[model samples]
Target chain A: MFGFCADPDTLGNVAWMACYLTTGKHMAIYLSVGTVLLLLAITAPAALAFGFAGASAARSRILPLSWLGRGYIAVVRGVPDIAFFLFFVIALDQFFEWIRHEVKCPDWDQPIRQGNDFVVCAEAKLPLGNAAQWVHETYGFFLAVLTFAIVFGAFAANVLYGAMRAVPRAQMETAEAYGMSPRQCYWRILVPQMWVYALPGLSNLWMVLIKATPLLFLLGVEDIVYWARELGGAKTARFTDYPHGDWRMWYFLALLVFYLLFTRVSEIVLDRIMKRLTHGQATSGGEAQRKAA
Target chain B: MSCLQTIADYGLRSIGIGERLLPREDFTLCQQFTLIGSGMIWNVYFGLIALLTGFFLATAVALGKASSNPLARKPSEWFIFVFRGSPLFIQFFFAYFAFLSLKSVSPIFDPFTSAWLGAAIVLFLNTAAYSGEIFYGALLSIPKGDTEAADAYGFSGLTKFRKITWPTMLRLAWPAYTNEAIFLFHATTLVYFSGFPAWRQKGDALYYANYFADKTFNPFVPYPILAGYFILVTLVIITVFGLVNRRLNRHLPQESRGRLKMRMNLIR
Candidate 1:
């Protein structure tokens, strides 16, 4: 990152530290934070959309749709999420490649699963085996995002479903008496009012999502956890210019501090948002606001 | 080999009891199921013990947090804040490395560096913090009239807590605690992935699943088998906790008693 970063061994104390921190691997570590943020930015809305559909389906009058939604929520809740993460990434990947194999290799009739191997054709390979490094990285990241969205979506669905139910029956009845259609009342009144109730649960979920980002390393993504483990292992003089003893403890300590700071900032922002959202509702926070004014 | 024979050879593989070497080639479905099922023992061990132990500690910590005394309250508050503020993944890594460092400084501490202790300690602490928050919420929501009634009858401190506060907290927190137990079981999959090395192939469910996935380059079988085992364990947890919850709230009037509703919103 700086001109003095060249010849790390020759550099003095502060300079060596600067160069040490600016190594190519360190750059990757910094980039992984961006990856974590990018994941949050993408997964939050995707999961919200999934949650919205799920909540709507769960509330549906149709029995089968409600069952499907209920089952989706139940299955995810019943299993450990890490199990789903490990399962879905592989399962989804195979499902995608299997579909592609059927489409791209119509002439090749041998089983896609021969004995123990999952041999998809060259064209059917996700990101293709010969593709650039960036494509592979992106593909892995995309899978992680999808996995996160699926797991957190179940959680968000539970929250939103509760929030929907918590919307007072009298409010809906009033809307109904005012000549509003069921759909119109749902959109104009219930949806708008439910968010104040949802905000607290959603804020909690956001903190959880932040904490879960570290699991990206387990999905084969070169995330911060991966970088910390890679860079902080004992590096002998033979292996690299900057010889260091076991520093994984320090690296992970840094990660711990990073996460604590991240969660703290999130708490502050979410609290502000909660206060704003509760400004004029019938909830306790809303009533407190009115009394204080 | 027959499935029974395969089970006999590898059913205790995760604990290094029967199989010395894992099947490298010619992996079969039966082997995957047997070995992965064996690995589930560790997951169950980690989840069950942690949840059981964490329950009492969580109750105590929650009570401490709700106490008027700053000496008791402050430590409990800080404990929850530290554990809840950081990611469990980082906690595992930090703890494993910290244990490793301790082992070097004192050879007597080497046994403590093992996964069974190190991972359990972290999970215990992590779950305690999470369930502490839930119990604290439940404690706060306990009806004032119940406490007043206890006071009117000369029930105070320990007696009051035993009669009123404890049961009410357990009843209110049961649903949330059930969710916490489920997530902790899920978190057991993370033990091997963190800094704790799976010595002698003695690892948890996801560990063996990953091993099979790597050897076969096919994740379709082993991972799902692990998931199945976990789903079964989760159901068992819900059933057991639900029964306990029923027992806790058994004395209350039917209309007055709050039902044990599973809310899956909170994650720790």
Candidate 2:
């Protein structure tokens, strides 16, 4: 914020706009975009890890593990993801808090669920009741990221499962002919080759994951959507530095353009990545590139 | 009240036919089930209507995009890109505000502020763009032999399309289109969550589920009920689409007709 922003009311239109955009709240709102990016950064790898585990579990020789993996993948088959986002935030929160309640409040006797209220002991509250405000927000964001990771992990698993199966049987057989164990074949041959198949699905999933970041607001994180609504509302003359009528439409429009640009950039980047990954592979994409060369 | 009476009262509550006020306390499983089931009507309404209406628009847009004409192709391409690129959630919010802003200038645009019309239009356009892209891809893939055969029969333009090109496109696009419909249904949950306000507490299944979750502070129960309802709905869509897929592929040789497997990874 510039020093001239000290008296925003008298500034010209351009100066006022500059001061308005650089307000502390606006800075927080700008940082909320980072919150979204950070969420995507965090959730992408977490979901991939979860997906890898789920895919491996499904492909396992053990019956129970396979069933559990299959169940996890099937969880997304029916329900809308927003439901899971909403459900898991509470369900996961309670599960953790309830665990803490058991450990931290062994002497407490009251039921955790008292009719309508979920009255966990004070000590069991996430981030502890006495913790700083930022700690509570961080806890919420962690839960939301976990929720995103869990839900999208199922989708990633579904994609990875197909990619794993799509790895031609001949490839795996040849690896076996070399006397490599199943595990070695899986890691060396199948895993490396699966990326070519998975890239398309994974790229699409990445797009979905990017789009889903807005739902972080519903999880109570002060993400872009939250900030947009907060900052873009009609600000009365007396209440704020610069008075503005309903500017939510403009705010949302900005978000729309931001998303459009993000997706466009992602598409270009992913296309290049796809080309890079497909090289020397046996898939159609690879086959075409070989022919082109 | 008995479960039967409660159902009779709250069964149509989502549509505002019965039960002026939702249950405040001591929520029963029956009430959660009934209300959430009632709320499902909105989901079905939004999904079916959007898909049906979008079908025609998608067909046109697909053709337009496939056209060699720059004028027709450019707008069609841009429409698809804009809708397909961004999040539907943001689209709803942005569209709602856009419509709200319009309410001042033109009285005719007043009703666009409501969820039923405003949100439905966004969902409809959103789906059309997606399906259009799918259809356009399928359209391009229609075997040259088939079109050559149509030309040999002295058929051209719309005649060739209605009889030959259209059926093949639908058949080819059917599997992906099924996935599109599934995602569209899942997307209807965002309507209430976005800027569109649910009038008189009337909302889709997720809305009622969220409500019960908030009130009872026990999300484990209601959300699962919502999920169960959705799973059934997904099955119904798949079955209906599967039958149509069969009819479209009726002329194809037996082995060539790919079975309709519900693949989970759909572009949202």
Candidate 3:
């Protein structure tokens, strides 16, 4: 915000619009955009780590680990991700609480699921029942982040699995012939060569991850979608100083345009990165660039 | 009541045919299956109708995007870009609000505010944009020799497109299009969860799944049921699409045929 004359009603249309945009709630909306970007920044790497583990496990020498990894990937693929969003937030919370309850409330005899309520001991409650509001909010956000990481991790695993397979056999064989162990071959040769194959799928996943941030509202993170609904609703003089009719359509339109621009910019940037990654590589893209050069 | 009785009572409950009220207490596995199974009708309806209708628009859009004329190309390009670029969740909310605004202007648009029509229209446009891009890629890849042979046979314009171009595009695009169909069906779950209200509790599978989850406070049962239903449908989709892929690629020799690999990683 800009400093202006303090009187709200006396402001002209231009000043009113400026004040409306700078209001506390609007500031929250702006901050929520950071929350989305933060989520992407955090979830992308975390999911990639999870994906690498899953992909490795799926390709493991041990049969059960491979089955477990493959099952995790397959489960998420079949279900609509929003279902997982809704389910995992609660399920994971309950799971954590159950662990806590087991340790903290060992003497308690009552079942945790009593009819409909999940009755964890107060000590087992996430963020504690008496915790500050921000604590609760942070806990919810943490759960959302984890939920996203797990679901998207499965997708990433699928991509990475394919990419790993796509690394030319001769490359791995060359690593083996040079007296490298299997682990060394995996890290030194196989992983390095898989990036070009994985980039297209990973970029697409990044876009999906970007698009999925709005579902943070469904997970109760007070993200942009939540703010859009909150601020854009019909406000009467009884509610606030800046009374206006429902402007949700305009707000949503703004969100749409934001996403469009974001995706378009990302597409351009990803294309550049893809080109850079493909340079001197064996893929078709590299061949094309080689021909052009 | 028995599972059979539960099925009888709530089998068509999603369409408001049988049960007047959803089970309020003591949730059973049968109830979860029946109610959620009942709700699959809507998902099937939305996905099938959208894919069927979107096919034609997608073809037109693909051709338009590939056209040499800027007048024809620009709009199609932007249409595909706008729809493909944004989240379908936002699209649902934005479309619902737009429909609500339109409904205020004229009662003729009243029905558009509901999930059945408004959501379907959004899904239709969204899938059309995606499938359009796929078809456009296929169109670009249509062999030069195939078209040259058509030209030699004096085929041009609509006749050439109908005879040689369109079928080849479909064949080439079929695998990607199959994935799009699966994605669309998965997306139908977002309808009720978004801005659109499920009128009188008539909603798709996820809606009932959410309802049961809310009531039972045990997500393990209902969500898995929903996932099972979805997996079954996904298999059916893959099978049906595989059949179509087979038919389209029938003219090719056995080994040269493109198999329908469900690369579910491409898009949501």
User: Could you say which candidate leads in DockQ?
Assistant: 2
- DockQ for candidate 3, C-alpha atoms: 0.68
In the order shown, the candidates' DockQ scores are 0.63, 0.70, 0.68
lDDT tens digits, residues B33-100, model 2? 99999999999999998999999999999999999999999999999999998988899999999998
What's the best-to-worst order under TM-score?
Answer: 2, 3, 1
Model 2, global lDDT? 0.91
Tens digits of per-residue lDDT, candidate 1, B107-206, equal: 8878767988889999999999999999999999988988888899999988888888898888888888888887788888889988899998888888
Order of quality (lDDT): 3, 2, 1
DockQ of predicted model 2: 0.70
Local error of candidate 2 at residue B185 (angstroms): 1.2
Clashes of each: 0, 0, 0
Residue A210 alpha-carbon offset, candidate 2, angstroms: 0.7
Which candidate model has the greater lDDT, 2 or 3? Answer: 3
List of clashing residue pairs for candidate 3: none
- How do all models score by TM-score? 0.93, 0.97, 0.97
Give stretches of model 2 more than 4 Å off. Answer: none
Give the top-scoring candidate (lDDT).
3
Model 2's A-chain: what TM-score? 0.97
Better of 2 and 3 by DockQ: 2
lDDT of 3 by residue, B3-93 (tens): 9999999999988898788999999889999999999999999999899999999999999999999999999999999999999989999
